[model samples]
Target: MVRWHVWIKEHEFLGKKGTSQDGFRDLLRASPTPKAVTGRNLSSEDLSKSSLQGRYEISRYAPVCLWEEDFSEVKQAFDDLRNRGIRDFRRHFEKHPEEILSFAGKVKINDVNEYTLELYQAKTKEDLLKGLEIVFSKQSYEVFKEELIALADGKTRFMSEAVNRTLNGEQIHILLSLAVPPGYKESLSRVIVCITDISAKQRKARELERIGEKYRKIFQNAIDAMFVADTETGIIMEANESAGKLLGMSTIQMVGMHFTEFHPKEEREAYRSIFEKHASRGRSLSDNLLVCQRNGRKIPVLFSSSIISLDGRNYIVGMFRRVLSPDHAQRHARAGKSLVTERKVSSHAKERLSGREREVLTLIAGGMSNRQMAEILCISEKTVETHRTRVMNKLNLHKTADLVRYAIASGFVS
Candidate 1:
């Protein structure tokens, strides 16, 4: 044997300070061979064993319960069944479930992590294995058998939610994932199964679905019209039944259309500006707007709007209520003047005025200038001015404002 000099570094001291070379030599002599300064014995077998032990330690502390199962026996049984002229494996398995159950029994639980013991409330690995029969009932076994067959037919992985029972007979929902390691054929493979308890997650999902259904009913039956639109483009995303009825359009027709389409062409731009301003500042309310129906009727409406964040995007949710104008109320009132009577009264009051004069008067009462009235009535500005003069003279009004007051009082501009 050759003599070797080892200079033990201060950091290499395992227990106490000032552990000299002489003390290390004594320790080396006490052992059969000198251990490496790295604290591991130098041997090929020891290195391999340490690597496996490290992997085992990682698996033991893993968040999910890990299982290694041998499916070779099941694969052999499947081959035997196929040899017996069973071409439709699924139908055969369903009819002769005993064969599938027998093969399931052949699946050996080669190993399991410590988490498996904790999850199943088992005192030992042996106890957990013994309880596997009770944990997997006949119904669940059929479902598992189908996945197992798929896995054996070159499918490298499988995932599904499964119902399992613990040792205490408490059922748990588990998200199960099974995969075969690379370079291993399914027939001769060891499957690695990862199980995560998803009972709470399933419960939460069901609760959210229930809440969503409840809100959907409320939205459909609401009396006020509701619209959800894209904040950036003003495109309608969703409209309730009330909104469709109020706007005189079907719900299907309202979706994907621009929200501004329901307003008068002249007011669309102004409405858009106000909507943007309110959205930027959070929320806004307006009671002076009118929504146009498909029949060309402009109905005054009260609107309240707010910005809503959904799925990381901004949306505008608006609620609208029809506002009953004085004219609208008069039209619908039961004891009010009949249509013929109202028309007669309207004609009698305006008998002294020409059609052009009446038109100019209405436009003037609506705050239109001569230029606007001329453009709208398809005439010249000088002609509009002449009509205004005649209207003021015929009405015996001294000022232009007086003409407006007279037109309003007579319901000419309503």
Candidate 2:
């Protein structure tokens, strides 16, 4: 047996004692050949062995699960399979899925660290090695097949995510990093594998995906026209269904178009200035804006915008509310002047009005015209006009000011 021991100070067990009080300092300044052992020197093999032992010590105490595997047998098995005219391992494995487990059994587990045992809930190395199949999940076969292909192609390293299980049958998400050590690629005699637990990270990711899906559904089904744009580029990143309908375009068509493109070309520069001001100030509302539809018809809208940040980039979320008309301000002031009338809608007129007609009347009292009501109710302008006409005929109120007074006296809008 050959053994080596390094001591900082001479011990009594070696039957040796240092003369100087500072043994370390003296040793550093000593001759290459000490007088006590002048002819004896450490061999090259001894130094190499000691270096390997140091590395083994490091692996034993590492915090992560470390594995040392021998793949020479598996390599030979692959060679035999390839010689049998099996060029596509993936297709062959797919046809004979059970062969994957058979090949996995061929891989020899040379050694594993303490952390490996802990991670698999094994009390000892032997316990883990005895039931190796219990730790692998069904998904592991896919990852293993990829590793095999990488090995067949002479790749030096491979990395992937896989699902594993513990002895107690608890599933674990893990990231596996596998590599052939330098000079070992030809024989693949020594392969190193590292496994990191990523269960918590994957769980959080899944949770975020669910939350994002929920909000995405809400945004797509919103009642108001909404847009998300890049402030720097002025490009529309997102538009909801209501926005597409109001602008006479599909949601797909609205995306990637400039925000100013939806406005009148002659007034684009003015709208761009307002958009920049809204983006800079973080939040704004302007009712004097107009949006041009695909058919070249212009519609007045109340536009409100707020700045938002997502994934380190700033964006503007703008919402558009359709207004009564281009001359709505004058009509609104006129309606306000006649709201103090004592004339109330009769019960006969109230009963004659259908639900939709009454709804239109209420919206009219709220200062919405046919186009604006059509946008809000998601109906056509003709349908909204029909409802408005029915309400007027039922109430015997033809003027806009008379409808406003009647709606107020009837307690439809307060």
Best by lDDT: 2
Q: Rate the local accuracy (lDDT) of all candidates.
A: 0.65, 0.69
Q: Residue by residue across 185-226, what tens digits does model 1's lDDT show?
A: 646435556777778998899899998787677557656677
Worst 10 residues of 1 by lDDT: 1-10
So what's the TM-score on candidate 2? 0.65
| Candidate 1 wrong stretches, greater than 4 Å | 1-45, 85-99, 137-142, 181-189, 327-414
Please name the candidate that would achieve the greatest TM-score relative to the true structure. 2
**C-alpha lDDT of candidate 1 relative to the true structure:** 0.65
* Native-to-model Cα distance after best TM-score fit, residue 103 in candidate 2, in Å: 0.6
